[model samples]
Target: MASESPEMNRLHPFSAVTTTLNRGIVGLSVPFFLIGVLSSVTDAVDPVWSIYLAPIGLVAGVAYGLTYYYRFEYALTQDTFDLSSGVFSRRSREIPFRRIQNVDVRQGLVQQLLGVAVVTIETAGGGDTEAQLNFVSEDEANRLQREIRRLTAAANGERSATEAETASSDEDEDEEATSNETADLETAATPERHSDPGVSEDERHEQPVDHGEPTRLFELSSRELGLYSFTSFSFAAVGGVLFLLLFANDAIFGLLISMAEPLGGPANLDSASPLEYGVFGIISLVNGLALTYLFSVVYTFLGYYGFQVGRAGEDLVYERGLLQRYSGSIPLEKVQSLTVSDNPLQRQIGYAGLWIETAGYGPDSGGGSQSAIPLARKRRVYGFAERLSGLERPSFRRPTTVARRRYLGRYSIIAGVVVAGAFGLSLVTAVENWWLAAVVFLAVPPAAHLRWVNLGYYVGEDNLVIRSGFWKRRTTVVPYYRLQTVSTRRSIFQRRLGLASLVVDTASSRTFFWATPTIYDLEYEVAREINETTRQRLQSALRERARSSDSEDGDAGVSVAFT
Candidate 1:
């Protein structure tokens, strides 16, 4: 029998109340609480009204949330997914499967407690194209994500097969047979539409997909994790340690005031020598720094206790976190950039950090999607990068002597201005000693020289490598085709110096600024050459990928798991 036509379905029934409460807490509760606090402190509103404001606001929020939930509906069609939502202003969207770039399942503390998750659908075009189904059961959300992946893969497979057949008439019969087989497979894989209106589309079909055991690449041991924490050097941990050292003693002494008066009293070191006091202060400072480092180490260990990364099919799967237990996968093809970096201490210890930046996975997504390898050796970093991008390391081109001179002049001018200003202010206000500023300004030339020497970029056959930084060095490798834009930019200063910066932008939002991959302080001609080379390389990569894809489609079997 033919399955009933797919129809729009409501989220889990409990989602209404759970969502209402969640919304109330996020949107209304805070405002109401603040208003109540303000009202009690001031005469803006009657005290009696303030007392009822929270309950009233909560009720209104629930009412609005329920109405919004009732209006929202989602349906899966053969070619596209449809979403209809909005209470006052109705909004409807039909997103083609081809446009969908990523489907993510996210669960927060509240969602975890309620056993529900939010499934976000990120498309090639962001903003309005992005669709979210919130407050679905965890099981339902996973099922929905899998279904979307399956449908999208099937669609892509068919399209690729058609393109292959069009390109080669000799494979038309084989292509036709593949199409029939794919249709049969899709039909067999997709479960019939659930008859019960109460059952969500996802909940109706939750069959698991079995792939071979994942090949483990890296796993953090307890000892390695401990070492990682020690090197993490988190500012938050240092600040926390400082806070405890400064303020915690007061509370402890306050509790035992009568017994601790003598011990808490100010020290009378007048009888002691200045050398003794100096030694004591130095020891105390060392202890404080050690305590802070220990705290940072502990935090790192907890954060990455069970970190493990592996390759499963065409995806890189990583699971970590002791308390949160986060597990995420990044499609190898979606990865836009990979960075291997190290601080001075980490470098000395022969360790580097790895970060994989992918499209549609911004830092705002709780940092779950961005692949971060906390600590690894240089070889391991390159190995992971090679597996993910299928590109080897490229030799970098260092900055020219003229560029170094330009950097020196630029840094000296800026440093001189700041130092002169500080010195003048100190002399006028009778504050700090002026000689300090002069001493700092003297180091500007070497600082600039080091920066220029450290800065370098390489445009390779299939990848671009950018090396930068002094204190914490980083080498970012970006695939040619991943680049979205390549341009030569010049500031007024750069123009005067006959120098320009080459900015390579990609779809990965994880980069510091609009996904920028920059090579700075190059001669104008060199910058333009680099930009042109990047453009040509990108075009070549695209054509190569197209040809490779066509050839893959003509092959007997192609795993569309990541497509």
Candidate 2:
């Protein structure tokens, strides 16, 4: 029996009343409660004001939400996926099945409680707002994944060995078999097999492919997301202990309060003594430690409300959301590398964050997909990356941190300019005599260098990782295949020094390496090599995909799975 096209699949039943009410309740009810409480406690305004204003707000919210909701629509065809959405305006996005890079299903706290998840579909378009979905059932999410995978496979298998095999097998069984058929099948055998990697003798003998999560797959629960966020010593995964400490101090006790309540006196007071302050300091230290732990627990519950990740068909699905949903999916082929990392404190906690890099997406949308696998089983990282690699040969070889040390020089230079510019401006604006200029010149260089040193990026043959920041450092990874375009850049100064930068642009993003990290002065040698390697890698992938198609004889096996 022929499978139904995706458009014929069930549409999510719409309930205008329920959806409108949900918007009203969420937007208006909260405000009403707050204002009601305020009215009761203080006579800031008339009690009747909130009663009338609250309903008006509720009505407005419902109207706006429903207007937007009604405009949104998504449906799938046999070969292309269509998403049309807008409130006052309309946008119809059509993406071919083969262009889909990944599918992500996510649920936030509210959606989880309501038993709905958001499905984000990513394509090769390279546009912002890459993810799109409001709420879909768990079953629907899986079905979509299987269906899309089937479509891609079909696109890949157009002229596959299966066609020749089936055609030849049919011919052999028929008494009317044409003599020309046997010769054609034999001619096609080699190219057909080459076109599809799974089209060999082993495939002929193997069982049919199954689009189900492996029975042995591991998963995380909502509680685990919260627990891992709290207990996992992946301190660096969240924030630095040093800065967290300072933040904790300022939050709990105001700067003004702390200064005013100092044991002896404020810094301006001559009578203030270190001995007197020491007594209060010990007590404050204990209070700060306890409060910091509490603060983290609160943050965890609020941020990672319904985080979950596990196997989905032939790949991995990671879902997370708080108030709004965010999800990411990594096809086996799209993944470039996998890594596990821990800071010194995190190592002690016996828990580490799972690190993932794909062809181009990253933590900030420029690199490979990133997941802070909170509370990852320490031993599983190796086996997981290896398993995925087995399914899809990585575009590059081993992961390399060669880019790590190289980043510091460029970082230092950028920081030097920014800091020096600020201080230099201060010098020009300062009053005559300009005693502040001396201080400005003295302070800027070291401060900028320290700022640069705070961030680092690592590169591997298969994956590239870049991390930057002082107070809030972020790390991103990009894979080679996901790269849509590659270019080398050189500023006049950098060109003079012979240093060049590489930018790996995906459809929706640009992953930039400004100035070769290793060589302080620009080196054209490194820049040309990176640009050349990127071009070669991209060409090879396209050729392989194209050749595979020709071999398959043009019939793509769209895996329309039975839910």
Candidate 3:
């Protein structure tokens, strides 16, 4: 790709588009922001002709300045990488080749149309001292990826020429071994045997090969993405609706104050003109469901809209974005675990979520790197994740939920606390309502019962799969290594019942409200079994790897030990 001068380069590459876009988007929401400001000013002023120009200008200027600072320049140097930007701070990021972990090339819709892709290089250490680049042509993207890979390999003292000759002769033998072995990765045979360094981005271009699958750059059916309005966080559509509805300032205020209470249930109840109430109920129910569906549609569109996923070399790449396109890639070897989820609804419909838990992408990520792929069949999830996970048997296990009776008792206690608190407060304050407490009491029993029935776990060779959710059920799998920590807890009631809750914490932004409270008791024997087995397995694997390396060192006649 031809290099563009900074003066004319409008496309943001190696720049903070997220930060710039944040400013622009927020600045553009002036209409919404102004409404509140104008209303408050108008109420305070006698002459409404007076304006608040200073505040308006100040807000826009600050946002613009923020956006400007976010632009940057990044380049891959001969032996090191560097990134420079920041409006006032003018900070520069430079790192040696050894610090780089992985390189990614991503292309979103607009980028694809423009024949451009963003190349990202990530490292494991903390602090904002790493390099990040944003926009480059597809040619440059490939070139940059190879450059980083070459430098990183060289830094590790990789003997590429020797490794290549050895790998070429080993390939046939490895293929034969693959036939005999039950499992072996496709990549293991090739080992990325390449000898080119200092190759230009344009020179690195290679013709693409067919993968024999439906090479869908974009995957979505009209009914699935549009009609169902589904997303990774299913039923989270409600939160989006509530956010929009919060702009329903009138409604929010009505709720906040006791103003809506004396409206006497809006004449929609059965007792107040039964026919009218029935008609209203029909209308209200439809409206509520439609409103709920709206959330699904918006989430599906904004987050996963224009989603495109495909394989690039040995990596699985996914690109999705609406106003701003985002593309990311994951190396197969970096992946630590694979998770599959299916709700009753999803099972009936034949669609499941495929998730990859990668060590690079935080093995502790509970949901793993996800794909919006519609692998509906049970066999399909296994078939795909197995291939995606290099054909390893995923440790598939269902999460255990405490029995219905146990949950019921817990809910009963929660309900009693809420009810008693409300009942006592109502008498003393005359401000609190006892009816809300009654609804809580009625609701807890069935919700708890449903929760218990829905909870289950599946244990596979390498992953533990968890399935739960009442209405819009969700199943997620988390590997034992993905766990940051694990603990057990039990209430007095649970102690009496001879059950304890096992909680596994993964590093995720996903809330643990529904997740942590559940994770019912695994017997001491079962808990010990899992811990000991994994611990021993990990130890044996590490020792085996060490032994192999030692043999390699011995073959090279390298002496170390006490020397």
Top TM-score model:
1
lDDT of each: 0.65, 0.50, 0.50
lDDT of 3: 0.50
Error of 3 at 321 (Å): 3.8
| Clash numbers, per candidate | 0, 31, 20
Against the true structure, what is each candidate's TM-score? 0.70, 0.52, 0.60
| Alpha-carbon shift of residue 19 in model 3 (angstroms) | 12
lDDT for each residue of candidate 3 in 1-563, tens digit (9 for 90 to 100): 11322322223433344555565566545544665567776775333322354345446755774556444556656556766666657776677776554465556667678777766666545423145555676776666665555454343333322433444434344333322321123223222212223222432332233222213322544545553345334457787666766676755434423322243333323245544554555655555567777667675666556665654433455666575555555544345445566555666666565655443332113233445354334554555554443334434343344456776777888888888888888888855668677777678777787787766655544445555676555555554434555666666766666666566555432343334323565554465565555455445545544564444332211111100
- TM match of model 3 to true structure: 0.60
For residues 1-563, what per-residue lDDT tens digits would candidate 2 score against the true structure?
01334343322443344567787877777667778888889998666776678888888879967876776666677677777776667787777775667776666666667766667777544544464666767678767777776565454334243544445433223212211222232233334334543222532332212334422233455655655666633233345445655666544545433644645434432455665455446656655565556666665555555665554443455655566565555554455444445443444544455655544334323444466465554444333433333212223221122333344455556656766666677678743543333444455455555444544443344444444443333333444445666667777756655556565554332345222122122246755776677677666645655554444432111110100
Candidate 1 is scored at a TM of 0.70
RMSD of 3: 11.0
- Model 1 lDDT per residue over 41-100, tens place: 888766566446667777777887888889888877776778888888998888877666
List candidate 2 segments past 4 Å from native: 1-15, 22-75, 82-95, 126-133, 150-209, 214-314, 319-328, 334-368, 372-563
